[model samples]
Target: MIRLQSLTYAYRKGAPVIDGLTVDLPSDRRLAILGAQQSGKTTLVQLLAGLITPSSGSIERLARLSFPAGYQRGFRMASTLGQNITFAAKIYGADADEVIGFVADVTGLGAMVDRPLRDLSVQDRMNTSFALTYALPFDTYLFDNTFTVGEPDFRAKCLAMFEARSRTSGMIVATKFARTASQFCDCALVLIKGQATYYDNVAQGVAAYEQSLPVAQPKPAAEAPTGA
Candidate 1:
């Protein structure tokens, strides 16, 4: 279980990104975080991942957590794919070869595993990142729009993997894709201007977002340009 009690944060004094936000994440539930740009979605994920400290309040975590940050793909270019994954495995004290094999099988990174990371395509790099994260045993997983970069089939596969993992561990996914979120998430958090409103269902979340938008008024046709 993950709990945040009166959490608050600010990059500049008196200008908070997350302000006294409190929530609990029941284990093994897939939660989708929806918010417009600058709504503090990424900031919330970072805090949960322990990448940043909260200015006030407390966060309680029950188990290990892993966050797939935007820069995780850079690890793919650090060395051979196998080498990078093995390094992570060593940090976690897992058998490197065994972990590599399992990741290769699960992520379908067969021959690509042996190749230098620079040679891999964007999809392959994403696969490597996911493989490394999934190989680790963590109780909570935080994904920040990583699936948006892959091809359709690969994206589908990634979604399946996330769903499978969610059956055993908690997952918090922050994305702009409503359709994808609706397909996998058990609950949705709709954030507007840094304030989060809970939505028990994805459809309700989407409807709320649509209702918040101001309808566009059509512009009158421009008069014919004066004779040049």
Candidate 2:
């Protein structure tokens, strides 16, 4: 379980991005964080992962969470994909061989695993990174709007991988779409403005989110030409 107390964050001389909020996140199931653009979803995820410090208040994390999966920022473009995996596994104390093997098999990197990251195409690199994300052990996995990346087949495979992980680990996925939330999550956390509401059922939360979205207004037809 994670406890968030009076959480607040703000940039310098700016309005609060996350205002006085408190919630308990129990790591027992999948949770979808639903939000519109700039709704603080990414900020909240980073705070929970201990990647960023909240400007005020506190967070108590009692479980280990993987960094945003397929996060390629930490990878060195000059090194081989396998080299990167070996280094990360050492950092997390996971078996390097197992992770490397998994990445090779899932991404079809095979011998390319021994090649430099600079040599792989962007698509291959992305696939490899995603495979490596699932190769580690964590109590819960974290994601930040990464569900639609790559080709359709790759996206489908990644979703399947997430489902497979769900059987043993927890996941917190942040997305802007209610459909995406309802598709993969049992519960939902909706972030509107700076406030949040946690719904036990995905349907309820999706309804709340849909209600918040602005309805598109049809354009008025051009006025008919006035008779001279």
Candidate 3:
């Protein structure tokens, strides 16, 4: 389980992104986080993954957590894919050979697996990283946006991969994709105005998100000058 108590964070003083947020996420469940741009969704994901520290609160983690799949973390641009995979497996006490082989097969990078990450394109890097994370074992997987990783067929492949893993592992997905949240998540959190609203139903969360959106004020109509 992961718990946040009075969590608050901001890039600069006087302007907070997350304000006194509190939530508890349990294992073996798919939880979706929904928010508009700059609403602290990414920041919350990072905090939950222990990537960044909260400014004035606490985060308690009781389960093995994976880095948000799309975020670059433990990779070296100068290192080969194989080398990074090996290092990750070693740190995690996993079998390096098996993890490396699995990532190579899943990424389908072929002979390029031995090449430096700097030589790969952005898409290739994402594919490689995605495969590498999947190769490692963890209780919960955090994903910023699962659909952003690959092409259509590749995204489908990733979906299949997650479908298999979901049976055993928990997931926390932060996304703007309503379809993805509804399809994969049983619960949801809508982040708005530096606050979070929890909902048992994903659709309800989506509705709340829509409702929380700032409404545009109507322009005042000009009238005849002083009733001339």
Task: Write the residue-wise lDDT of candidate 1 on 110-143 in tens digits.
Answer: 7877788888877677666776676777787888
Kindly list the per-residue Cα lDDT of model 3 for residues 58-153, writing each as its tens digit: 988888888888656678999987788788899877999999888778778768768997888998888877877777898988888663367877
TM-scores for every predicted model:
0.79, 0.93, 0.88
Ranking by TM-score: 2, 3, 1
Q: Which stretches in model 2 have alpha-carbon errors above 4 Å?
A: 225-228
- RMSD (CA, Å), candidate 3 to true, equals 4.3
**lDDT of every model, 2 decimals:** 0.75, 0.87, 0.83
Supply every candidate's count of residue pairs whose N, Cα or C atoms clash at under 3 angstroms: 0, 0, 0
What are the per-model C-alpha RMSD values against the true structure? 3.3, 1.6, 4.3
Estimate the lDDT of model 3: 0.83
Which ten residues in a row are the worst by lDDT in model 1? 67-76
Local error of candidate 2 at 114, Å?
2.1
lDDT of 2: 0.87
Segments of candidate 1 deviating more than 4 angstroms: 69-79, 93-95, 106-123, 219-228
Native-structure RMSD, model 1: 3.3
